[model samples]
Target: MTPPRLTPVAERAVLVEFGTVVDAAVHAAVLALDRALGADPVPGQVEVVPAMVNLLVVFDPLVTDHAAVRAALASRLADLVPEAGQGAVHEVPVCYDGAFGRDLAAVAAQAGCSVEAVIAAHLAGEYHVAMYGFAPGYAYLTGVPEPIRLPRKPAPVRGVPAGSVIIAAGQCLVTTLTMPTGWWVIGRSPTPILTGDPARPFLFAVGDRVRFRRVGVDALAGTQSGALPAPGGA
Candidate 1:
């Protein structure tokens, strides 16, 4: 495939959009290209940020012109290779109690199912980290089942605590910091996503697969328990 087309984002950045909607194949393509580009970056490239269906390449105008950087990206895309279905699969534990998941009843009602059913659906699928954005280390996950693909709250919540498990627009997302969000808060993760250590700032990364393991309130204590077996040998 010739891929699709590229559009200029700004003087320093350009967006390469794979498609108009989110899909696993396109997402994998974006991550594969991102890794390939990083290994042999375009001259003057600063960073590459992958989104649902676009790859934003940031370059330095001082070092190289926009035309030169864009041309390099085009050439790289032509020689793209299909990525293996390989990535670190992580098991994130979440507490679905009343205090943490206040919106559970509403969400369950909207889905025509009970609260336990809602939790079951959210925990049932293998979600992939499409991209880390909207906040530092906050992952945009794919594979949220249709039953629990609830829309964001009509009124955005303020100060949703860190480690919140939220679902919005057919995707599951987790917060790394206390922030306002429109997504329905379904549960809270015990894992701290952002660490003080820069080397391992995030618990998840682009292309990584995550499976939410349903647990009780006491399971929160096991965040550092290391009790859960590592997924995929991670």
Candidate 2:
């Protein structure tokens, strides 16, 4: 495994930065370290949070100092291997037409392609859940094909409906709640990304692969998008 740069988050916690850019290998390393820490923990480890290309390890300062934390991380990663660890695969249905995707036309114009082409590109690429943030169950996904990648809008939109799937910064996201955003609102997902249920709060997890499946508005009727059909599966 590639070594991570050990940075201090304070006197206690440590941020294990794996890479400067978001990459598949970096994501794998992040998750690998996360699993290892949970499976065979270091002393005073308070929490192990995974991000796009790094892991935030919060430990109890009283029990373990910075040096000890660093040493534990190094020891744990010494023989570590990047993993794909039984993560789930999700085929989320999306509504890309009409008001649900107000920015579809804009994205198509920016990409210099037809609306159909933009949707096709999104559906074609298999995305990885790099991390979740900005809100509960709100995931930041990578693997937006380079050809269609766009920057966040110069100005942010006030609020988008929950289930909106926006794209920007070479990534895609499914909104967990009604919130304002700078990313282009390309579509709306049929499934709710966040939930109050304790059993399954988020539909996806880091390392899980997802492919967006275009769906008609009728399909979303009466179906709770976040409604789990089954407990767990890829």
Candidate 3:
């Protein structure tokens, strides 16, 4: 099959369109192309950012034009190879009690389910790390079942603590920093997704599988508000 359509986005970036929907196939294509680019470096390439259904490839215009980049990408995409066992599965521990999950009640009401049911659904989801964006180590995850997909908050909440598990845009994310967000707050995780170390700055990568685990409010009682543990443990 032909690869995603590549279109110029500004003077130095190109957007590769996989489709107008979020799914594993679309993400796979994006990852495949990204991997191919990394294996065979793109001339003048600055960075490549993956999204739900697209890949934003930025290059240095001084070294190459959009046409050249597009042609090179086309060649690369044509030879794209799928990755086997592409990403790791991380089980994120989330405290879903009322104190941590502000929108939990509302989400339950919207889905015609009880709070326990909402928690169950969220935990039952088998999600994929679609891409990382919006902030450092902020991983946008796919596979949040539609019933729990609520719209972003009417206004952004200020100072949402790190490790917050929020959902919106038909997906979810584990916050890596204490920052404002418009997404619906659902839970909190103590597992830090970001690290200062250069070798493993981010815990999850594009295509990583994420499963949510329900942690009790007591588990978060003694924890500091924003102090997060590295990548695992409840």
Identify the leading candidate in terms of lDDT. Answer: 2
Q: Write the per-residue lDDT of candidate 3 for residues 76-171, one digit (tens) a residue.
A: 987877674578989888997655787788888988999888888888898888888877888888878878878787899787778789988678
lDDT of each residue in 4-81, candidate 1, tens digit only: 578877678878888887776777778878888878999999999988888999989889877887799888888888
lDDT of 2 by residue, 1-234 (tens): 355899998777899988888777888889888878989999999988899878899999888888999998999989787767457889988988777778888988999999999999999988888888777788888889876899999989875777778999678998877778899988777677765578987888777889999998676566665431221111
Q: Which stretches of model 2 miss by more than 4 angstroms?
A: 84-86, 225-234
lDDT of each: 0.80, 0.82, 0.81
Candidate 3, number of clashes? 0
TM-score of each: 0.89, 0.90, 0.86
> Which of the two, 1 or 2, has more TM-score?
2
TM value for model 1: 0.89
**Backbone clash count, each prediction separately:** 0, 4, 0
- Point out the higher-scoring one by TM-score: 1 or 3: 1
Candidate No. with top TM-score: 2
